[model samples]
Target: MSDKRPLLDTSDIESEKDGIMGAKESSLLMTGITYKSTTVAPTVVWYGRQLLVRRKLFVGLLVVFIFSYFLIGPADVLDLDNVDSIVQVHHQSNVLDREVNQKLLLPKGYLVYSNQCRIVDLDPYKREVMRHFKRVSYKPCKQRLPLTQMRYDDHTRRYVLSINSTAFQSYHVKNVLSCCYMGVERVSESNVSYTHCEHFKSKAQISNTTDSVIVKCSTEKGQIYINGHATIPERLQIRQRLKQWKRRDQGRRVPSVLMIGIDSISRVNLIRAMPKTAQYLYDNDWFELAGYNKIDDNTFPNIMALMVGYNLSNAMKYCNPYVSGGLDKCDFVWKLYKKHGYVTSYGEDAVKINTFNYLKKGFKQPPVDYYLRPYLSAAEKLLDGNVVLGLPHCLGFETESEHVYNYALEFARRYRNDSFFGFFWTNTHSHGDISQTSSMDDYLKDYLQRLLAQGTLEHSIVVFFSDHGLRFGPTRSTWSGHLEERLPFLFIWLPPFLRAERPEFVKALRENRNRLTTPYDLHMTLKHILTLSGRTGKLETLDGAKDCPQCQSLLLPVPLNRSCEDVAIEDHWCTCWSYKAINKNSKTMRHLGERVVHYLNDYVTSFRNGSLAHLCQPLTLQGISAAYKARLSDDDPSQTQIYWLTFSTAPNQALYEATVRYNKSSTSEDNVQVTGSVSRLNSYSGEADCMNDFAIKKYCYCHHKSG
Candidate 1:
């Protein structure tokens, strides 16, 4: 083992460095035209819009346009200082979709065209145009860089470096750009290809100890190239370093937990809205709990259940947050992980209207090591990008889901090796117009794939879940919609090794796919994971753990016929039963219909917000839409019979639905009890619009009359 490594020659190193630096000047000159925030109308024609022009003349025209754009100001052009404002203006104008080809004639040998600037390419080989930034450079051990792509001259075997024609917009700014030289010898022929340019960008050295060589050098321009070769031993060292850089925890057995939650998405709708993510989870052996039920309505109650295994009603009864009882002392599942030496963090996109923030007084201090409330405030007030939580309402880009995905990605990247529990809940996409979430399918797929590719999820239990279904959309009016409201999507991705080692557990999870489950079960699963990692550090052993009273881990057997009552699911929210529609004129329908109308009347009066006048005196039964038979005593059909009915009420002429339990005989005895679950499908008039501002407006049909 005596001196097996080869030594590098100084002469070779000197020549390599010289080739990389090319020709360095003592002081750099900025002669080429530079434009900062220039608004160039695409129709600006250089050289009379000629398809083909002399290279010399083309270059000269660029110089003139550069002077006009730099020295003078852009004429008759709208400034895009606020991207959203400009985009909104575009959105309002029908011309945004008119697809007008905007041409900005510039002096350039190669032609590039965009909707913003349309150019006719004169070159023999026209290239495809891409939207994102080109060419990204990073320093050693730096944070993740934005995804970038640069134009390449395949014939010249170099990067296209003309400042006027460069697509590297970030290079326009000194701070956003960096200079790097990769010292390499191509191993896998595929690895050397940059056709998928992001592949090249991803290979950029993100850490100080990475195999790829990167350096910072002062230069007058943005484009630079690397020139270097390594000795045999150096190449081996580079390989080792590359391998190590890719894996943050190469041999660690401990697994981390990363939960990315989407608000107001049901299991069925999750598949519809995010098919790519759904397929990805399925393809990767991730388990999906199809019957995952919500214990209560809205984000706060469901989140309370997921975090502390307690519903909002229970939490309010004991340590109520509405009464200023801080959740810092609450026995949340994250607290257990924190107690076991794990870093716990929580984040939600709309912190102003966050489940705990709006429903109750938010935490006095951060409940976790890293809470995102402050960041949300800063992002909303200071920075505006792909995601913006605006005032009154959190207005965001359609790519807001991707923005939240990036935050979670950053967290996982930062703490890849640490035992951590991080929860990220995003409401920007699904909370309001759930139709926008359909576009997030590919975004989510890409995010999960990136985590898997970067090895961030190798030692983690990742969950992509949601609170409940679309709560305020037209889809919420259907019978299936009512059922969907109680069913949220739950996808869990376990480490490959664990799944392979414990096939029984994986099988159990797959078995529980159609079995009824709840967020409390998720809590129980997390608890099992935490407890298994006791003093022995043996997490693979998950035996002898008892299931909580109302929750069962998906990793364990869950009885297929598990009732809603067994899982503490309130009767109103239960959708595990079969139902049949009775005729509108049927005796049962008449009784149930009357009960529903009376229930709506009582509900309106309960508000007492001056809607008493609007309250119905002679409640006309327009029609009974549908009815589902609920649990009844078979011994006597009249003994406490519950009928779920969708009927309409009058005065306000609004449509309402309710589950009413009543006992009616041939004599038509008026003994009816209204169930707590009452829903308003449609409101015809503003008569009962006073309670529209309230969160519980589903039950409020009262209008304030101003004298």
Candidate 2:
């Protein structure tokens, strides 16, 4: 104590205290804090610095965690299951950034409203249509190992059959695989039956007289029989067939025609479901018809329009598909092509639901030189496959569609140098779930690439097209679905030489893309191909569609003012008109729905000369589901106000959709006529088991079923 008093004076102590106070004040000032002298400012400043350091560390760690979560998360989180998932993710992102309200402006002053019909690829409403069904990837069944295999020897022009020893051993059966060839024959237009075994052998060299053969495999004893297989021996019988061509001209090069048809796909759906194939087509500068509308309700009418240039009424009158040898009498364009020295081939994947053979007489004779019906007819019975999405998915080791493609490829390869016309239609894969079309993308792209690599397209015209959109599905209920069902995908590709020589035709096709078109125009286009030459000024004039005389080839420019009526497009199947939503619960809509149901009942009661009147119970309006009024532009002055109503019915709770015309100018009951066929929105399978008429089956509810 004595030393501290002596060592430090009062002034020294005061000076040291003042310096410490000044440092504290500076720290408080830097931190923008004003406090009384009694407060501990330095302690507060120290705590603030420590908290800031901790926050920075926490933020850095949080960001690292987020990055790791995204990088190491389950793949399904980012993987899109179908078109709907892709659209939803895109739509959600767009919603976060800005409002999304997009519309596709159609030609002739028509507008495709986003609120009504959304054909836009990324529209969120696509989710609504797709949500009804689960996303389905092609999980093909395991490859079925056959007891025998057939290989075609081009040198011998015969099929060599071989037995698989391993397959026989795996079954713990005898390796003695005896086989016999069942010859295929057309009994009648509606019937294709096979003959009994003619040449039975353990190892056989089959004749190339027939295009398809059913080879039955069994043990030598004829017991414990093995499954058989349908073989299509790809034989180039060009020398024999070319002898029929009398008007052969080696001087001029005519384009080969190849039509690859996929059933029940819309133009927009093409982009959504088969992006890779669509992109390949786009990248190759394929001419796509934006306004290619369907002419009628289903594949029969629409396809007939293209094949024969005839409407349903005219086709029934002229072709009469129900009668034997009636289709043979029809003037199909393929006949014309054949007469003009072109090798013609026609094939379809699904034999049961083939365009010509589905509940109708096919052809008394083979329609084309290389017909695939006999092969498919036999394959359906012998092949082991699964019925996926209500259609056959696989045939043994390959998908059903692959058989069609392989057949087409072989046909093209065989006739690459000749002027040929090949029509290959596939229904199994695309006709089912719309999402299943995605499975065909890479394969289709590869197919086209193969065609390109083989130089098959050097002097050829390829048409990749569809009949219509989904005719029966959960999608069929949406507004976009309505339009999609009307507008099918149509693409035309010309050879590079043709594109370079006939720039005018390419230009016209590009211009015609936005204009209204139909299968009638396509029929004319095929005819126009018959006249295409290396030297071009103007293509020769060909007869137009019988029903639609105004329809012309796609190589010519389509009129901008062209109406759906000009192209023979029915009002129900016309996509040129826009619609706006109306109140579904309103009195007017309710009455309209009732009227529609009444009309449906009357239709069933009067159908087929009152045949269904006794069998089908009368349908009553259960409730109105949705309603829309047509919004016609100034250009369509003659069109009356139309209403599209969707409603449910009693007994089955069956959904029905129809387009009704309400003429305010008239004072008659006929003013409210249904424009097109009344669509049954839901399945009426068991209820309509009594009837076979495809048209009446939709409205009929059998009296046999318990109420």
Candidate 2 lDDT tens digits, 459-482: 899999999988777777766577
1-707 in candidate 1: lDDT tens per residue?
11111111233245435532432221122223334534554543442243234445556645654553342222111112211211010101121112211222223321212111111111110010001101111112212222232223435423321222233443345543444433322222112211111123222322222222212222467433221111111123333433443354454466689999988887656654565566667666677766687877678767877778776656666556755446656777777777665666777766556777664666655676655555345334322243322322222221334445655676576567557788888887677544556556666778888999878777888888998876654555554466667777888888876777677777677666556778778877887777544423443453322223746667787775476667777656665543444455688788668766765556555544644435324355778766666533233434666667777665445566677666664345456766545666653335445443223455443534322
- Cα RMSD to the true fold for all candidates: 25.2, 16.5
List candidate 2 stretches off by more than 4 Å.
Answer: 1-125, 130-135, 144-154, 159-181, 189-204, 216-247, 533-541, 635-639
lDDT over C-alpha atoms for residue 414 of model 1? 55
Residue 388 deviation, candidate 2, in Å?
A: 1.3
Please tell me which predicted candidate would have the highest TM-score against the true structure: 2
- TM-score between candidate 1 and the true structure: 0.58
Q: How many pairs of residues collide in each model?
A: 5, 0
